[model samples]
Target: MQSPFDEPGRIFSNKRPLEEDYTPDTILCRDEEIDRYSEALQDVIEGFGPNNVFIYGQTGNGKTVVTRVMMDHLQNETHKHDVDLTILEVNCNKHDSIFNVLLELVNQLRDPDDQVKDQGPTKGYLWNTLYDELDRLGGDVLVVLDEVDMLGHDNDKLLYDFPRARKNGDLENARIGVIGISNNHMFKDELDPRVKSTLCESEIFFSPYDATQLSEILDHYAGLVFKDSVLEDGVIPLCAAKAAQEQGDAREALDLLETAGNIARKENADTVTEDHVERASDRVEEQRVLTIVRDQLTSQMKLALLATTFLNIDESAEPRAKNIYQVYKNICKTCGYEPRSKRRLNDFLDSIRLYGLLERDERNLGRAGGRSYIHTLEVEPELVFEGLEYDSDGDDSVLNQAGIVPSPEDTDQYSLESFGA
Candidate 1:
């Protein structure tokens, strides 16, 4: 009477509910935040101009979720109060530049069959058209720009102009409210004073969750995700501690728990355990680094990292910019790709270093010599090497001929991933 499909284990009752996009039925530990945000949005009901709110916080800090919750409330209350309200939400990351952003707005507000061009009329024309459409609707309209910093320099004009459409005589009716949300802490400081005063009429800051808060959030989702008697008591605490120490990121804590459950489930274990969490952490971090490098970095940057990894695998070596550059040149030559200038290579190294995947230290040789920056892989070399394979030209003979991949007899024993101090 054994079930063939039972070997995957019963650790997960529901997986989707525990995902990052899952919105919980109950939002805990944010009653004060919810109330404050709701109060700010209440202007729609009072016939007054909607308050332009700027929300700033770290990633996974409940900013998006809380905003969605308030938007739901605003939608319902506006309907009940017989007020005309149109809520438009756009993630600035998806539409970074001003032209693209305006195009998105035009598409969203205009007739579906009457789509706009990629680089249609001037952005001012699109803006005026958008204002005309909103005025035709005749109600209070709120535009929420999430990851507002992604707008970069263009955000100045977008922010400075949105709230003042009526005052500036661009619209005959319909008051516009701008809500800009961002994760960049320095974004506000870089903003023009005029933009800061206009867009940041009401500001709300969401602080990172502590261990206790993350623990509660984790336990809540875990209970819904797993069946009874499927997880050890210590599992949640361990995951919570790891995520809290890192950044108090609830999403990370949830991911850790979910990954541990998956690991234990794959092994057909009766319950998730601490050991699974430990292994899951390593895999998650490795995958995070791999995904970042393989997808985000350019070919030259990959070569730079590959060079660093090659030197890193040798214990008796110092990986410097010069060494990395030489290796990068060799790689480019092998792959039939043109090599960039040394200055450009330095720019690539700067980007890699800033990415937090590599650690660099400046050491002064002596009064007779200038300082040199030594580079080391913060990520494990094995992960980097494996990730670099995805960047390979997809031909083994070429790699072997180019001396990029060492033969078995070249070393006593070696693994591309193994590294020394």
Candidate 2:
């Protein structure tokens, strides 16, 4: 059962710290936000009442992590006084609708013998049940709703009633406090004015960390993730700098380092170096584009995109939608799929433009010709082609024929009629 040839050294000490849910014991560069957040929840600590907190910021900001850290500290402190404090955390992304959220809450609270079905109860009945359960608990309850923007599927009935749990006489013993976390700033503004007033009583806006803050965050995680001296000099700085420019995302920085460490491990390299980080960055960017293509686009849509990219790259064709559609039809035949109608193909192009994979502009034709749209790839043409190649199985004969890799000069060259067909 022993395999001596398979044994190899790892560059990472631990990988848990790099994961999204793994909150480091010591949070870096968020003291000010944490202090303000704690103060917002001071009422719960003083045993006076509860508070409603609304936290909003861009992705990768320290909103959710900071809250979790403070919640841990709060729980420990409250337990010392023999207080019955319960924490109910729900990611609205996972449990989006009112019914799903209520069902999950009841599932967490109710006894195993009295477990509810996946879905059955009316909205009112569910709320009544939740209040009854919380009241029975006879303690302070903190319900932290992450991804609050996705709640109730376009309605805020649950959010409106969260802070009003006590006011509406839903609970008697357990004082319910709600903390709503959202990355979408418009979520609060679009809410009912009444809900907005109460839910956002203590609004804490978390700004993105600066480069120095990101660097500090990277350093903290690097020390935890890597062995004592296996890291190279410039790896952290480069990762930090890249992340800083991209909204100062600490998660992005950690991901870069993790990917670099993985690259080093795979290559059997001695140490994680700057070159590895550079390659990792490219890998991340490629994955980013590839994810958009592979996840969001249909098979025919990808073929259309490939055709457009080929036209843009090889033929120096006009970026007009019509021109692209002609090449798209040609590519569909090459790839053994029936080409879609022009109307439907234009719809795909519009969606691609919306995704920012490509850009579009309305162009005015002469009096005889009607107006049309011209488009260009927002990302590098080669990157999109490469991403498409990675997604495609087996050999890409269409890409080869289209000269995506730049073909040698041929005496007998194809005419524009072939591309149009």
Candidate 3:
């Protein structure tokens, strides 16, 4: 039976579980991690002993996903045995302060009416609320602190307080366990000895996916995301191979597949092939560079990138930072924003260099030509500017101010010349 393309709902097919769509039931290909997690969590159910486990890995390496899934499973299994188990998950990035974290937990425990906000004495009061809530609950509790390293290295009090609370006589009935998930391996190394002892009872590391694993993961996603007729046989493998070569990141492989699928659909193609993947890679790579540019840039730095982009769009102007700054100052005037001074602007350019948006170089002129430094944009200014969300202006405000006119007949390729020899 052949499917018709005219039908809107059936156009694209997918087999992979997207990050948003990922669930305990749907997660696949992480058996080793699952086994280790389940083993560490089983003690709580069996009443033998609960272990504090730390999970560490790079972004999108399934640390949170697996921990959440395993914890959910543990909770369910514990419930069947008439055991009272509470798992509270908190993202430390948002609930960073001790008071805030305890407030969240207290809110979770208390009825809405009992929860107080403005009745603050100090953070000491909030810790009391947390203790009272846990003590009132009177059962075993598991605290999953995601991105725990964000709590700052010195503030290991929460780490010490949660797991050791039972042993330290903070709570009589509630046996507490802490599972800390972090992206940084050095987090444990930097931890204070007391906090480190509590949080590092067991540690599991998730290694990045290799090319084979990425291929398998992408194959699952491609089958679920694209239409059966949309993807040719080799497309998934190619995308996977490229992503693995760059970074053994599963999410990156999935992004590549999704982006390629999007491009194919936009082109109204019946079948996605290698050509679509290649084209999609260019667009995705451009977007990746743009994201790097956008995140690391301040408003003034963005203006610099915008200026460089505008210059690159102009046929005559060389993509130099000094020239770009001349244009940037004009842009700041047009946008009604105060311009940063030249020294400050230089700092912004140095940051842009760190972000890989632009390159800095020194030109050593032979005795005939004296040495001077130069600047250039490494990427296409038009693309970079689009990423920065800057708009184009028609009036040559920059040219008028600099007393420079662009030559229409100029033909030169801009290269990011290296600085410091």
Most TM-score-accurate candidate = 1
What residue runs in model 3 are displaced by over 4 Å at the alpha carbon? 1-7, 14-16, 19-21, 24-26, 118-121, 285-421
TM-scores of the models, in the order given: 0.74, 0.70, 0.68
Model 3, TM vs. native: 0.68
Question: Which residue pairs show backbone clashes in model 2?
Answer: none
lDDT of each: 0.76, 0.75, 0.69
List, residue by residue over 62-94, the lDDT tens digit for candidate 3.
Answer: 788788778778988988987888888888755
TM-score of 1: 0.74
Ranking 1 against 2 by TM-score, winner: 1
